[model samples]
Target: MLKAGEELDMRINELKKYDTITIDNLKEIIDTHLFLTNVFSDISGHNNRSLASKYLHFHVPNMFYIFDSRAIQGAKSYVMSDKQLRASLAPFGDKEYIELVIRLFTFQEHVKSQFGMTVTPRVIDSFLLNY
Candidate 1:
């Protein structure tokens, strides 16, 4: 527990250097999420991607996109059904968490252009959850 807290503290400090999420800083954001997931997974002996992402999202809501089975399925479904989205999305690679962030960023832009309203990560999560 002590080690886990220390690891989290260190990651939080690293994350504090970033003021916001942007295409330029996205790699660092994803690296932070992967680092936290590995840290907790090492301590807990379970896959911690979802938990790590949720925790990071709590601290940096605008920067980190929450990941879970439901949201993954929703994103997959939505992307598959939208022709323009399929063409626009970058090809997914081995890092699925990175793919999710890219998808969410693209989806956010799509929504803003289609509806003339900007949405946050939380709003995107809600849409995915209810999709």
Candidate 2:
């Protein structure tokens, strides 16, 4: 536990160097998230992607999208229903959290184009959670 905490601290300090999340830096952010997720998964012997996302989201609420079962299911349902949205997102890879961030970015654009309302990660999260 102590070792994991120290590692998490070190990684988070590195992450703190980024002032904001943007397309240019998103890959690096996801790499950090994967690192944290793997650290927890190593300790718990189970996948911890959601927990890692939530932790990072808590620290940088505006930057990281909160990944939970409900949101993931909602994203699947939504994409399945909208061919355009599904087509807009690139094919998923082993790192699903990266795909989720890309989906959120595409969704943000979709909402703006369809409804003229600019949405944030938090708003998208609420929509997904409630969907």
Highest-lDDT candidate: 1
Model 2: per-residue Cα lDDT over 5-122, one tens digit each = 8876776776677654555656556766777787777888988888888897887666678887787787766653334533433332225676577667667767777999777678
Candidate 1 per-residue lDDT over residues 1-131, each given as its tens digit: 77767877786777677655555666667777877777777878987888888998898777787898888887776653434433333242126676677777777767777999778778889888887
Cα distance off (Å), candidate 1, residue 127: 1.0
CA displacement after TM-score superposition, residue 5 of candidate 2 (Å) = 4.4
- Give all TM-scores, in the order shown: 0.73, 0.70
Q: List clashing residue pairs in candidate 1.
A: none
How much does candidate 1 score in TM-score? Answer: 0.73
What is the C-alpha local distance difference test score of candidate 2?
A: 0.70
In candidate 2 the C-alpha lDDT for residue 129 amounts to 77
The list of candidate 1 runs beyond 4 A from truth reads 1-20, 80-94
Indicate which candidate wins on TM-score. Answer: 1
Angstrom error at residue 107, model 2: 0.6
